[model samples]
Target: MTLRACGLIIFRKLHEVSAAAVGDNIEYLLLQTSYGTHHWTPPKGHVDPGEDDLQTALRETQEEAGLDASQFTILEGFKKELNYTVKGKPKTVIYWLAKMKDNSAEIRLSSEHQAFRWLALNEACKLAGYKDMQTTFREAQQFLCSQA
Candidate 1:
């Protein structure tokens, strides 16, 4: 059986910049997992039974990051699917792009993640580590840039 997961690529626009220059102001949220290789990623978790993909994304974001749905605005047009294998089993992860409603909103990480950071596009890609994750961030940055 395949393992499935979903998450939001949460970002905030820095208040120091103008709304018209969203590209310069955008910072992506990344969480550093407490376990394993201590890999960094966006808030994500396995899909619970009876939960749809989008629901799983929102729930996991709230549970892992302490940011509820009201804290951010989901971007309707951008979504990404990543396929890979874990322990010899295939896994799929879906991610939606979202912009934080308030740039000053504090991040509260659960025990699953030891730390979190808000970084610009290039720095986010470097910390994300995995090739697929890097690609995801790049695409997300591009999407936000286009919106500007």
Candidate 2:
């Protein structure tokens, strides 16, 4: 059976500087895992047996990043699913875009992650490192821009 996980592509809007810099005003959140290769990723984890994907995403986001549902708004129209192989097993991960309600909300990290950063799209993509993850961040940027 394939491994399934879910997460939120959490982002925040910076204070307006200029209309032309809309894209530059958004930043994404990434967490550096403490295990394995210590790669950075959005808050995510394996789904529990009885939990739905979105529930898992919310729960994991709270557990991993300490941002609860009240702290962010889930963007209704955007979601991404990625399929890949990990340790010879097929894995599927789903992500929904969320916008932080307050840019200054404190993040309390769980032991699963060692560090966290809120970064611009290019910086987030570079820190994420994987091609597919980079593509996901780019797509999220497009979605947010289109909505703007």
List pairs with backbone clashes in candidate 1. Answer: none
Each prediction's whole-model lDDT (CA): 0.92, 0.96
Highest lDDT model number: 2
For each candidate in turn, the TM-score is 0.95, 0.97
Residue pairs that clash (backbone atoms under 3 angstroms), model 2: none
* lDDT by residue (tens digit), candidate 1, 28-87: 999999999999999988999999999999999999999999999999899999999999
- Candidate 2 lDDT over 1-148, as tens digits, reads 9999999999998886565677999999999999999999999999999999999999999999999999999998999999999999999999999999999899999999999999999999999999999999999998888877
RMSD of 1: 1.5
Q: Runs in model 1 with CA error above 4 Å?
A: 16-21
Models, CA RMSD each: 1.5, 1.0
